[model samples]
Target: MTGAPSPGLGCVGAPRLLAGLDRMPRLDRTAHLGVHGQLPQLGPDELIALAEDIELRGRGGAGFPFARKLRAVSRSARARDGSTAVVVNGSEGEPSCLKDTALLLHAPHLVLDGALLSAAALGAEDVVVAVTRTDVEQSVREAVAERGPAGRRVRVVRLPERFVTGEGTALVSGLNGGAALPSGQKVRTSERGLNGVPTLLSNTETFAQLAVAARLGAAQYRTAGLASEPGTVLLTVAGSTVVETPTGTSLAYVLDLCGTEPGQGVLVGGFHGRWLDPASARASEVSRKSLAAFDAVLGAGAVLPLPQDTCPAGEVARVTRWMAKESAGQCGPCVRGLPALADVLEDAVRGGGAAALDAVRTRMAVVRGRGACSHPDGTSSFVASALAAFPEEFRDHALGSGCGRRVLGALPLPEDENPERLVVDWTLCKGHGLCVDILPDVVRLDADGYPAEASMPVPGRLRPKALRAVRRCPALALRIRE
Candidate 1:
């Protein structure tokens, strides 16, 4: 079967955003006369009960229980202080995922309500919504304006679109007026978030669910979904061929969606996520625990179906290369390790010897859990999962020749319009050739004597050397693409 049609509000075809619109309970006009009726204020105990009843897990890829996170913040007496804060992370940096943007755009009230309710429950006086500088910001801004007074108290902050900039810590840094990057030190936002206060930060959809939970008591919220994981989830579906089967397509498309048959494969949870064969995933349910049963979860709600006619191995190689580049370059292991893993994956795709596959396995083991952040771990997961899920494709490429098809960019990038590319301005070239000496894999000296071969795969291991080369180049001809 083919993939389902693209829904509205970032969902492929169905109106996922409008699912609970009419179902939302009417607000008490007397209590909220001056306040926007969009938000339904939830009590603390009710919120906890609702979360436990629905078993709502964090939508920020980690799949941690919402109740657990709440307890963590609530356990601390410091949470009672007005210094505590609630942050709505609308910065959907994962290129393959558009569910957050959908929530913010078409269902801003739901997201805002969740944030406001979370603040009230956590005893936080301030709530901030952090969004990318792109289209998401405009939608949230309009939502804030429509709410009038209630929205005024909720601050909306715009952020750069860097891939890592959307990480929880990075978002906190941005709100604190620092550069949009992860900190070198180990710090939890709950301990010190905006203005050095306890913060409850979560994905936009998580907050939307929170709002829903607050409105419907825990018992009612638990009515839907499995006992381990109650409630619906938002997913951005993509693939070479759209699968019409929809086991996890949300309420809007659940009736129309059908699940893919056996033998098919899909990329779940975006770039940092994993790949699974439909055959192996036949029994896989859409819940967090169900996916985890298969060593996978509905990460950040992204599901991409791969086409049978397309080269899965080639696709993996292409994405692996991009993943290597997305690293923040803060940690040495991530900066250097991901590129090495990507190269090995690429070699395997290009019909390289068994050594390539062996090298990938070895390097993957070394890179996993070594980064200051989760970048290296995520990259390793994507690679390792692809290898496990698509053994046939890997074997084919290894035994035979190339996959034959050109690398089609099925996966999205931080800047799909303009992918990162190396550039060298020859006008400034004094032929110092320090770049050539430093990054032989990326740059080489040509017949003209000046360094040429500007375009090359940037290996993670060579990033420091490459950066050194760029810095040492007196002429400043070499520049890394953003």
Candidate 2:
């Protein structure tokens, strides 16, 4: 959970998102009034037209066009027979990301204003603001409460702080009182979501940007950032502070602002994002067009620089393990393949030679494009990019001996707050093999045809399946214990 906003939030230079943010400590109604003046009341058509004029993409990892999403939801809502719902995805599950929490905690009214504006535009009466942390939940509820009757229309739902829970469909699923997991199929949330009606779901920052753009209009908003990607973006500088910087800010400048020096590789985007070569990162700017020139993504506005003292290979290994642990474990690829990839990477990091290198390549191929969600794909990107960016370190670990440095936990991992593991009561087992039949991804049979792989963390996606398997067991052998 985020603390007081005093030191944690601000802008580096000229603040757009953070503009009028500093004057008041916390952006209450008075502070919000001082900062943004007033919410720009826009009709659905006007809002969509203004979004198109500004060419605003989502601030979320997908970088989808906001105008397109708005139109889709509007069209879907018109075609459907039920009411539409709007969701504010405030679940900042990425470990390196703090911008969403900071913005919600500080300038929450702006986010709410954007949501309400979108809800009104989409002809949606029900608005759901989903957050993960207690403080953020309280802050958003308080912000909503400040609006009186209008605020009461917005429903704030608290969610689990899992990495994939912030996913649009997952948020919808959770809000609908189902398991908070991405579906095993591709379905646009706009067409069918939130009580099975059309839903306009976007990141917290995206809504905040909408509020800013609604107030600033197209021309004024374009005055600050790049021609290709205009407006200020919120960046969660992992080692430093959460600041709202212009879209086309230089990567080197961002690094410098975060107290990082040049010639060190930086991980642009969040954990699911890629790694940039040191020189390439410095030469590039933080815009979609600019980074696309180098075939990179400016994902989620998370810029984490690699610590100079830490071994790049070791750091990758450590982060890979965490990513493996974070797997939703629904698909076979993510559940089994991630740990396999992590093991191979660790082997290569520990000087396990050519076999391990071959295994890494092979396993990466095996894991990619196999998950219900992008967890497997994103993990592959993270690992593949690390291998490409730090070839020398991989070479040293593979060819010579090792980097000789211990794995420094440069990247952050959520503390193991929930250490629950799935276990099977071997004594109660009768070799039924029922558990294997149910959740083949997480459970397998031994050579003797009994259930094996007893102790493991059940992915949020697979919990229902796991529970089904547990109950279906004739001997009542399988159980989950904390």
Candidate 3:
């Protein structure tokens, strides 16, 4: 049987994944081939009107209304220069998220149309698409290279693939050639981004949706999804179990939208997202506030179903460990607290003592809002949600038995891009043996009283101790597998 028809007029297939997308009218291919007629450009008021008509919310995780973001940037636009910059944030740093890359690869022009239209609407002078050093960047770069005069002012910026690097502020910081980390100083990218210029920055999918809305108008755009949401949403569906469903599934998978069949559970938004029973999900709408009411949001466009065979607690623990490692190590809370939380989670999964669960909760509370960015907050949300959603799993594990299966690492983790283990600067080492003392399971001292055996699993039981070791190390010679 043929797959479901694509959603919306411009593109179709799975809202997020672009499998079988080759037959569709790809915006990227059209622009790259110098097909200017197909590219739609809207003036500021027209673009604003289009945005208002569709009632398009930001497609990024936050789900801020597009019109609000536009207004914020427009208000910041200087009267003297009448100039603003549009930033297309394609940095898909969330390990489990692939929606941004899918759009960049399959429909580059859609995003460009949105950005260019928004820029014109705001009287902005420049458009910059920020992507990570991945295949997505190469595709976007080629698309940019192919644009004739229309793409002249548009540029593609390649960024590091760190977790925090994709945050709006971090992306702006990286574009300025600074370290790719969010600043503690409260500042809006719209008020100041890419060299202190007034800017309009949004996720790539947001721009593509804007482009579609501009062409189709609000009434046409509202035909597909719920009245409250008013448009189809792209969702990256990843799970162990696969289900065969009809094509053209409506965008609003609201609680009322989903049929009677019980869903296992869903990770709405991305890693920094929350969990809800698939059954409970049926009652939830796809609107920003609706999802928020359920303690969830339509984040960076990822909605993953958890298979029954896989243990949710085990999965949460694995992702927590990965999140711990992804810390940029700039702040004490993230640098120290995440590993501690991860350790507790790993212990809980291993069926450790009640102390382990208590430790995890304590560390999560300590780490929340303590990072230079939202990394800790996101990590804490994932863990806390899992604990709340799967009380039975936590109770079973607290008995100090086991979850019975090995962690499958269903949630993606950034692999060690640097293949080597921790390199100790021996000269910096004063033989304090704090590393060994804190993480005795992983780090042990040699007969000479020097640190050795650094390649063992850091135990969850010793997280607090390990953090003390990390803090007390005078030489700072000890490092995790980078």
Candidate 4:
């Protein structure tokens, strides 16, 4: 588990999911069985009882209770054809988070045991494990092969790695042979998922936790964590180390243990998570309740401690721009509002003064609760929290000045894919001005009604509008280039 996914792969008290990493880095079938013992097969009711007794919750962003999901899918199955499917959302698409990858890469059997046990109890014949990386896929495949006949019903699928690709609806859609994009409408995975059947979908660590809970039973599982919240949580600390820290552990201790400190502040979650001031970060604990007390979320278990040297406003701008490009391009808020927000933030950081800073605040309010998914709201939160947490720095920048420190490029962003931009077919031009009405910001008519900038590096936010312009062009002169 310490193989790059986490450099300092240690634990607080005792590691649960990351139990035997020191002795056997990669727990093959023999070592896995020896360390964790056999997978216990529990009935549906018994499984739900164990989850409820242990107060088990998903390790994913929302932290929904696993028992409630299991019960919902169970009822749906009985109401329908007794058909249910189990999905392991191992898609660690976020660039900073790596606990799921550590678990899948090192302890694949533990995850499989949790998934296979659930599938058997649910009476579901189909089980699909969705991943993003190829090597991680190979590790899972090897684990399945080690299981032999027991792993027949389990199928592994690799999806495109993106910020929102790991969402429940997107993963479900991808499993059904469709694009890995979230549905515009709300999708109840427990009701109809993976080919129109009741499905029990959960995060990678959630399932792994379930497997550990089953082996130890609820009583033993309760012994590991506090009375308020039981069991250890997997935290991707400082974007480099993955620690199996128990709930209610001090956040400051984790950072110090991982050889980092809260400089400017701490980003408790990944990109979508909130920023806490040094005091809040120091006082905070690892549990959901503890983080929630400070209006922060223990989301995805990514505890990123920002360094003091880098400019806070510039770092926020860099992340905002990257998130704008990661938009699903589904709604107006995403296709328009996010890029607008990014532009305003960049402007504010580069001495745009009060006007740009006010624009940033206005856009934050406008984009909240206005997207098909939580993507827009998440981006808005990241900006809003930065503004709140580091007001003095932002105020200085707003007064036509900067922090003088360079943007150290501390945050993570993936390599850019082949993004599309508008292209004009000069041969098929008819000088129609229809394109101008559709894309006012992009298509400026020259002396002749033609695009002035022939090859514009179109931002991801305007791709949808550009398409609209291309379709509406009366001359059929508009085209797209990769």
Candidate 5:
């Protein structure tokens, strides 16, 4: 289950998570123990205190405070007679992300230590590490096997590698034996998750970072990076290479080291992240606050400096279209508004005049904060930033002129996945009608309200709807064929 850790190439100044990785690329049990030493033994209060002292924040896109989350779950568990669980989110589904993959593949034990250690502190019975890649799962599973009884408490699970499937609720649903789609409902994982128990779910990097902080303690850990946000962060540069640089490192240095030139602009964060002009990119640092000041987020730490040769307008249209398709299809804003926004942006690229530009703005407004999840708002921010980031290129498109450069697919996208079928487990099925309601065109209820067929061939376009139906079936009978 162990594999060679993915070594980052460019600027990995003052590596923390990847400490000793260059010499010891493959961190097996012995190497992990030798390098990082044993995980600190801390009680619930001490763990929360250490997290607060270090100012630990989730490295996931949202950047929620780690202490706040721990406190919430701890309080919820105490209120519920002291029962809880922990989930380590290793589902790095973004094509523009590899930091989590790097951490999980190379330093699996660090991530495990964080999750398991936290579980012990919170008195949680279960520790689940949800991953998307096979290599990562295998690596972590091997790491778990090394711990014997402790490993028994850890479960390595794989979810559908969809973009939105990384959402905490989506991972919870998948682990609960439902489809990996975010429910339109707003249920907090801290209160009820994973078998309807109070659970602490955080990103892969967050846990790994937590492990690093626990080992270093408060004062020593604060030695690196900014005083406020002390520590190193893993940046998935341009999607191909991963860099574990300190928090205060210059964004330009990382880009330059990765052989990227901020030509038109750099896309900070990932698809759901915002764009920054070249000037802003030069001014910003790796810290979250630095990027925020420039109206961008260090979300998922994905930084892509645009190449000068590609048409900025065309590239925006393509990425916007992809983001739209990646939607969960659970809300009206995403189901319609996002696709419409993409269409208008494409129209603007094709010399569709100012009216087309106005149409794009209109759709952005329509979708903003209107979805069950943050997809609509995030997608809207991405498009809006594109408009402001590259004014000249967009102005050319708006005035019925076009940027002469062709779209070189400067932004990377994931390859197509193998086609899958939907099947109902006969044991779980009870002639449920929920699937029928969601997929009226494809599925029909029998007189007894069971599916007409045991299995159905789901088309690519309607797969999201089918997945949604599979999750909503109270009987848990509907399942996507593996």
Candidate 6:
């Protein structure tokens, strides 16, 4: 299933997950064999020890200790008297992210090597790689086919392409034929996942690094990056180009790689990530530990640079609106509070007074940690960081007119195939109070007694009510669409 790997534009330093990607050859079975040779067969205890020795943490956003996750699943399997399962998550759900897909597309064999190696170590019979895009699926599938019987053991599940569908538990749910949404309750995927069996689920980059660490051993693996966070990390630079740079690489250097200088600020960790001013961003490094000082994490390897020419307040407003639309609509706070936050930001951008800023603060407080998932919390962090990071620009928008710069769209929000955005056909509308009355949480009326806007792409919780309102609309003005 492997195509020719893309020749990367060479690493600023050492490359691991993106090793030799500059050659631009997909590490197919033969090429993979030529480069890394055969995967070393390691017993479960040995692999876990090696991970511990190298302090290999999950490359996923949380940066959970890899050794701990392996031990948890292994111990759980032993207790249940049944084998565990492994899931290599490649569902790059965030619009500003593509590192997982890039890793698989260029080096599918490496991901497979890690997954297979992990399966043997964990005594798991089933291994699944969940991906959202078709290209990634094809690349990994071809690589699997090349492995023949060895590849047959690895299953590639194409998941729904939604922002939250890539959540660990949600990926597990989808793999088991359930809807691709995070569970309403807080449950670890390692404890009860994949048909109620303990599952070892890690990001694609984590597994790829697992293979690299197993091959290099602990001492060699620690050769690059800081002692605390060793090895290279694959990053999707600016939502477009992909690079594998050493951990702790300067954000300035990352901007250089992306061919853009630091502007007003830079967004680390994608839409759900935080914003840092130019100076703080340049001082910060790519590692999770380093980013923690800025109250940020290296979430999903997304690093976007915000241009100064663009109106920062307007850009933040647009992204906040998008994040609000992406909500699963599973929780009350996330469903209602996000749009409120976006509205305040937009109002500030449009020259609303200090009241808008107060509303933003209040709504941000209301949405924190009150969701079934982290959407509310993450979205809150995003908006709050925008305010804190660019106080001057935000204040200008709030107090005076805007910054006079148009929104340059420095932040990219890729279009979704199934948008599910809420819309109103104003041409067909007579004054309709049904929508406003039925879905009070979302729909509101304008001065002319017409439905204004319900924050298009109504949250999932209100969609049913929205649909009911749409159906009952005498003028048929309201509709939900992609």
Candidate that would win on TM-score: 4
List lDDT for all candidates, in order. Answer: 0.68, 0.80, 0.68, 0.86, 0.83, 0.80
Cα-lDDT of candidate 3: 0.68
Please, what are the lDDT tens digits per residue for candidate 5 over residues 97-190? 7888888888888998899889989999889999877788888989999888878989989888878988888889999999898887889999
Q: Quote model 2's TM-score.
A: 0.84
Q: Name model 4 segments beyond 4 Å from true.
A: 1-8, 417-482
Measured with C-alpha atoms, the lDDT of residue 95 in candidate 6 is: 68
lDDT tens readout by residue for model 6, 1-482 = 12223323336676677766667557788877777777898998899998898888787787899889998998888889777989998887776777787788888989888889989988888999998877888889999899898778889889878788888767888999988888878787778888789999998988888898888888999989888888888777766778878787887888887788778888888888888778888899878878889887887778888876887887788788888887887888778889888877777766678888988999999999788898888889888888899888888888976677766567777544354665788788788588777767666778988767744655433343466677889988778775
lDDT of 3 by residue, 127-230 (tens): 89998756676777777776777778898888887778877878889998998888867788778887788889999878877776666667866776556666
lDDT of 3 at 97: 68
lDDT of 5: 0.83
Please give the ranking of all candidate structures by lDDT, highest first, separated by commas. Answer: 4, 5, 2, 6, 3, 1
Please, what's the RMSD in Å of model 5? 12.0
Flag the better candidate by lDDT, 4 or 6. 4
Q: 1-482, model 2: which lDDT tens digit per residue?
A: 33323226756567766767666656887778876787878888899998998888888788899999999998898887858989999898877888888878888998998999999888799999998888888988899888888888899999887888888778888999988888877779889988999889899989988988898889998898888788888877763478778878887887777677554588888888888878888889878888888778888888778777777887777778778887887888888999999888877866678888889999999989878998899989988988888888898887647665543455655545564567988789899887777677677778999866769676433444466677788988888876
Clashing pairs in 4: none
Q: Which portions of model 3 miss their true places by more than 4 Å?
A: 1-28, 31-37, 239-264, 282-285, 418-482
- Model 6 spans > 4 angstroms off: 1-10, 416-482
The C-alpha TM-scores of every prediction are 0.76, 0.84, 0.77, 0.86, 0.84, 0.85
Compute the lDDT for candidate 4.
0.86
